[model samples]
Target: MLKKAILLIVLLNGLSPIWGQKYELKSIIFEGNNEISTSRLKGVTLSKESPMWFLQFLNSFSGLGAEAIYFDSSKILFDLAALEEYYRNYGYFEARFSYRYELDTSNFNANLIYTIIEGERSRFRSTFFYGLEGIPDQTYASLIQDYFNASNDWYNQATLEQNINNTINILLNSGYLNARFDSTIIFRDTSANSADLNIYISKGNRITVDTVIINKKGEGASLVNEELLRKITGIEQGSYYNQEEVKRSQIRLFRTGLFNSVIIIPEQNEVSANNVNLNLDGNIGYMHELSPEIIVNNQQSAFNIGLGANFIKKNFFGEARKLTLSTSFGIQDIFNVDFDNLIKRFSFRDTTLLGYVDARATIEQPFLFGKPIFGTWENYATIRKQKDYNITYYGSKITFEFELPKYTFVNFLSTYYNIEQTKEVYRTNNDSLASKLVSTIGVDLGKSTT
Candidate 1:
């Protein structure tokens, strides 16, 4: 009994170190996968290799960086199955996957390798679409020509599904709100290595906007006019219901800054309904805010620091109009002076002080003259105390903004007219002053996908 007990203790000691030691997954390698990329295969697997050595080294001390991925033996089985499934999705029905692992006991790291035997890949013999009879003739033709003209192409299930989704989106935007993917049929011939694909879509009754109901919430909601909100939403009562357009409308309302939260819900009583009612619920916050800002920038190759404040009024005078008043003062070349002397340089008598001051008042309206174009008017005054000269300017600007339809080359346009009067005084000869008046007009165009 004493000898047996000694042997058990010795065995426990020997296994303790191996059980507690951690083994990181150093790398994953794929071989014989010529048709598919190795990086793509890696994405489909559950096992993940550790980050680079330097990242892991830094992560050890901070515990917040990219940490090492420790090896898990149980995930290998799932990884093999995932790789095989991924191959089948790519039309490699006869593909086979096998794996082997190498463990470095000395460094406590592991390397996993996979070998893929990709057999004959299946090609598309015929593709067809069904139950698309009621759509517009142009739309139907576009769908068939763009998506289903895939005879003899490699049979890729991923690409096939993506095309189906895109087709459904076209239908949805065409006022078929209840349109959806129904089923997919695949007839495969193993001997010929070909497939016949069929996809069906169930497009319900085309829909139109019957009415729009506004529900206001939160404090100061009553300050926003429903008509102005409707104009900003861009959803009309008698227009065809479009899903993508509704999403865009919701985004526009959020951009107005009048609402803290915006939700536009399209509701239909039945699946086959022909009309949808849009319900717009908005949560409005305080109508006014006074906030301070600390500004830092490198302007004209010199670091500048400034302090500013703004007073904003939302839904000002109704109609979703906004008013903002702003002012700021900044000092240039801050780094060239000592901290103790920085505050002393603010005196107007100190010619060595290089600073600037600005003040502005701006008013913006969501729409102009009942049209979709946005408008803004601003008046500003600025004073700059330079080393050689001191200059002052008074200016006013009028700007008109237009949002163009999507898919166009230019999605946004802005045109402005600016007028300013400048007065300059030389520091060397304080009595010598120059005055000028300037006026300018400009337009800007931009494109955005989102």
Candidate 2:
């Protein structure tokens, strides 16, 4: 029996008016279901009650809530059949399903009620695996004892299917590139209310990489070299095939932001015995962009409006590097300020019409020293005038980030250093000026599963 079934229900919110139907399905209730929850049983059927009464009440005023479901006698048989099929998949082989409805003619609402007879559930009597030979003995044992341990539990098709996929992943990560799930057979004994499960898998010869072909598309492809992409992939000739590493490589390449699309295709058709060729295809987009925008901000409890522009150059210099430059200017307290002399007051020394001025430049390198580490450098300058203080600042920072392989205590690591100079002047005391230089260095390490 299939574990998951996609049930599509066509809602006829508009059909009631045409057919002059009066009863809207107000509630769906289940009774005598000892093993399965009512919510789960409802999820498997096409029949659904309308939204809650409060939601329907709110819908009358705002027109945004779950729509009403009119009673459809024609769908009762299909709903019951779906319920029976779901029960069988849950190992309730002798289950029975029946439904009744209560109609409130005065209110023009109907309540659907289902009765379930959950008979004896079948348990797994024995389970067997075939065709997982030639892999490590411990791996086979772990798959049996840990991954697919289905002891004393009712026969659940979904759990069995999920375990099969997990076992296949273990095989693929262990270099069995051609590993695949074949089929599962279940023998049910109605008299004993038990089942024997047989799962078959084909783990073909463990494969190694014979060669990797780098395929590029779009105009910006030449800006990044094949060597950098190959290093990013970490898949080399004569290396054992690992699906996890292949996925990680794809993620690394994508994190560069140089390519719009990336795909690592295993050339299994070109396999020779235990060796196969892989293809890494990347599609690049336009590498240069000049964007301008309007910035609205709340600074010092005042609403401010600004204009900004950014120029970005992708694949700058080489090796999938990126360069960005941006600048913005905004005025303070426009409601209380005079714009008649705005151009005359636009001076660094004049604080009358000044809000803030900020400019920044950044460069990003995908990798450093032929390693997985990523590096970034940024420099910025700013000037601001508020109700009490006026300030000017300039700063620069460099950061390096990288991710460790799996099974490590810390998977992500970052280190950065920043130095800045700031000068501030107070409005009340003209001579009260402060200037300082600050520096900081730190490291961050964390384990990430996403």
Candidate with maximal lDDT: 1
Q: lDDT values of the candidates?
A: 0.85, 0.83
Model 2, CA-based lDDT: 0.83
Residues 305-388 of candidate 2 have per-residue lDDT tens digits of 889999989878777788999999997677877678878776545556758899999999877887777899999999888767
Candidate 2: C-alpha RMSD to true structure equals 9.2
Worst 10 residues of 2 by lDDT: 1-10
In model 2, the Cα lDDT at residue 282 comes to: 90
lDDT of 1 by residue, 1-450 (tens): 999999999999997886688889999999999989989988999999899988878888987669889888899999999998898888898888888988788999989999989999998887778888778887677566645566678888888887788788878888888889999998888899998878888988888888778999888787777877888877777687888788878877776678899999989845437888889988988899999999898875788899999999988788778899999998887877456775776565565457799999999987678776779999999999877888999999999988787657999899999999999988688648999999999999999787
Report how far off residue 152 is in candidate 1 (Å).
6.5
What TM-score would candidate 1 get against the native?
Answer: 0.74
